[model samples]
Target: MDLDNLIVMANRIGLFFAAQPDRDEAMAGIAEHVKKFWEPRMRSQILAAIGTEAGAGLSEIVAAALTTHRAMLQPA
Candidate 1:
């Protein structure tokens, strides 16, 4: 998985989740229903999108990562 592509995808997923009425619940649903099913590399890519920098808290990044993981699992 390309890290940059994954980040872009994750950021998009984050934006989508952020737009929802219940952000935290959406994040949790994603973590529970999606992250577990993702390929290891895809999971890593999503997590990488949530940077470890001080400005990007781990929890927030994890949320984005999980959301992205879930989105990737969905069929078109």
Candidate 2:
């Protein structure tokens, strides 16, 4: 999978939820969207990108949401 593309997609998702009045809800929405929609492999790929230079492409919200809800987003 293309990590750059995934980061772009996730950043888009974060942009959408960032408008929410509630910060926590926005974060939850981002996590839930990825968890429910992304395949396990996709999820794993994106998760691995966190905190690395490749992950720097991620927006603040995407990075934070991914980091904050990591446990929940992790594929079994």
Candidate 3:
């Protein structure tokens, strides 16, 4: 998937998790959702995008989740 699509999807997940009462839980939810549902390449592409200007398009929550839970999102 393209970077834009990934950002959109991530933001969508962020939106869902943002409704949670706990900030930490919301962040973890975003990471877990991506890790569980997105393919390895999709995670890799998003990780790469996180290092570039394109990543600026990511929502604040998504960016925070990406930064806070990067290790979990990595391919294994």
Candidate 4:
């Protein structure tokens, strides 16, 4: 929705990836992979975070939720 929201979302997603020591590389290495199916706006938000590396802790979860939100917003 906005920058704050985007940051929170990204941070959450980051955390999830960070949690999984095994998958951390796969997750971090393939950051944009998750947003591939997202709408333009969600894609934009995730892209904005691509450079920041701000998605840690709760941010990863938020990002995951944003994906769900994007899916919900998309036309059926």
Number of the top TM-score candidate:
2
lDDT of 4 by residue, 1-76 (tens): 6656666655655665666666536353335544554456765655545336543433444444444444443333
Cα lDDT, all candidates: 0.54, 0.95, 0.91, 0.51
Model 3: how far residue 68 lies from native, Å: 0.8
Candidate 3, position 14, lDDT: 95
Model 2 scores a C-alpha lDDT of 0.95
Which candidate leads the pack in lDDT?
A: 2
Per-residue C-alpha lDDT of model 1 across residues 1-76, encoded as one tens digit per residue: 6665555655555555556688666676556543555566676555554545521433464456464555554443
Candidate no. 1 TM-score: 0.50
| Candidate 1 collision pairs | none
lDDT against true structure, model 1: 0.54
TM-score of 4: 0.45
Q: lDDT per residue, candidate 3, 1-76, as tens digits?
A: 7789889889999999999999999999999999999999999999888757989899888888888999999999
- For model 2, residues 1-76, the per-residue Cα lDDT tens digits are 8999999999999999999999899999999999999999999999999999988999998899999999998999
Query: Would you estimate the TM-scores of all the predictions?
Result: 0.50, 0.97, 0.94, 0.45
Cα RMSD (Å) per model?
Answer: 6.7, 0.5, 0.9, 8.1
Candidate 4 segments exceeding 4 Å error: 23-33, 49-76
